[model samples]
Target: TKETKLIDFNQCQQSSIENFIVNGNFPYESLEKFLVCFPKLCSLSINRLVRLNYLTEKDFNPIELKNLKSISFELHSIYFELLKALFKNFFKYIEILTISIYNDNGSNFFDGEQWEDLISTSIPKLRIFDFQHHYSGPMDHFLYACHSGDFRSEF
Candidate 1:
């Protein structure tokens, strides 16, 4: 499967690419273009998607890749509203989501309540939500909420 690797997507228009990963810095334009071209993509990983600018309404207007079920990405900071907008735009059918927050601003940005609310409202079909970070404190709180039926009680 080494030959099937898709590193540069500039000239790619493979509709049959079910699994895709962006190995390096990829512009939003290219990301949008590839997503539009790959209509049948079920799993997508944008590990190094460059954050040139904050995503706006115009950027979230794409209607392609409705079949995307699993997505993996890394976010530098907590931008819940931006994230909510992005999720609302294209992730309706997403079942599995893996996000690694590398740069959390501070303690104020680590609100577990907001995350739980976002999950319950935005991605209802989400079966597997994987969150990874260096800090284990927030994870403990999140896990405790889940195990104590606090998360379920909200639903």
Candidate 2:
């Protein structure tokens, strides 16, 4: 809290930042406040290391992520609900999407049946679809990963 308080937003003018990296467990309210300072944010990456995190609908009201073009998240226990919220609010013009998931929950993330329609609706301008998810319990992980430069066809 002390560190956050030290960065006075009133003294500093609007920022010109374009990219940001963060931990997935970071509080939504705090992150939303911090990102509002940078109106030009175009890329975001969430490094969720090894921990499994459940998606929290804690009212993530990002100030201005309208210019966001690329997003990458290390998705372990995170769900589609989080992604849907982000896409609805900020990923309208997004071009690149990279995601990774780890656990026995492969089917939840790897089901690509809705990819074409989702891209058409929420992320119409999407160009690259890079994704990976896997898990293993005494057995190896079941996985489906890809880095498709052109997302319109051959998905």
Candidate 3:
């Protein structure tokens, strides 16, 4: 795990690091810290993030990542709105995006059509999208909606 320590975020400012991955449960504020440190990051993958329960729409900031190409993250529950709002301002150049929402219920937390529209309009260069459910239950309607919305074909 020490090899994953690409930068000493607390000690020095790393503005040149291009790819970063946080594979453990880190606070959402750490992400904000990293964005301030790594302005040229092209890829980011956070396996799990903690302390996001208190997040609100106003908590988001417009940090443009014009060179961002890939992103992957897994969250405990539904936070599609948070993700959308983040991406709307940040990840305009994203090409590959992977999102896994754990503890997903059968109910939809986000509209597939809106996601499709976001992909079409916000991330026009998106080439690969992988969305997964990490819950233990019967297959949810969200899976069906992804297919019905023609999202699966884009990958």
Supply every candidate's count of residue pairs whose N, Cα or C atoms clash at under 3 angstroms.
0, 1, 0
Model 3, total clashes: 0
Write down the TM-score for model 2: 0.66
Strongest candidate by TM-score: 3
Clashing pairs for model 3 are none
lDDT of 1: 0.63
Q: Global CA lDDT of candidate 3, please?
A: 0.68
Query: Model 3, 11-119: lDDT tens per residue?
Result: 6566798998976865554565568788899999988754444544336567878888999888654366656666777787899999877654313544667777788
Each prediction's whole-model lDDT (CA): 0.63, 0.61, 0.68
Worst 10 residues of 3 by lDDT: 1-10
lDDT of 2 at 147: 24
Estimate, for each residue in 12-107, the C-alpha lDDT of model 2 and write its tens digit. Answer: 566898988875454333444556677798898877522222443546554446788888877544566556655766567889998776664445
Cα RMSD for predicted model 1: 6.7
lDDT of 1 by residue, 28-137 (tens): 43455567678888998877543445454335574645679999977544455656666776776799998765534223324667667777777778999886644457
What is the lDDT for 112 in model 1?
63
Return the TM-score for candidate 3, rounded to 2 decimals: 0.72
**TM-score winner, 2 or 3:** 3
TM-scores of all candidate predictions against the true structure: 0.66, 0.66, 0.72
Which pairs clash in the backbone of model 1? none
Angstrom error of the Cα, residue 65, model 3: value is: 1.3
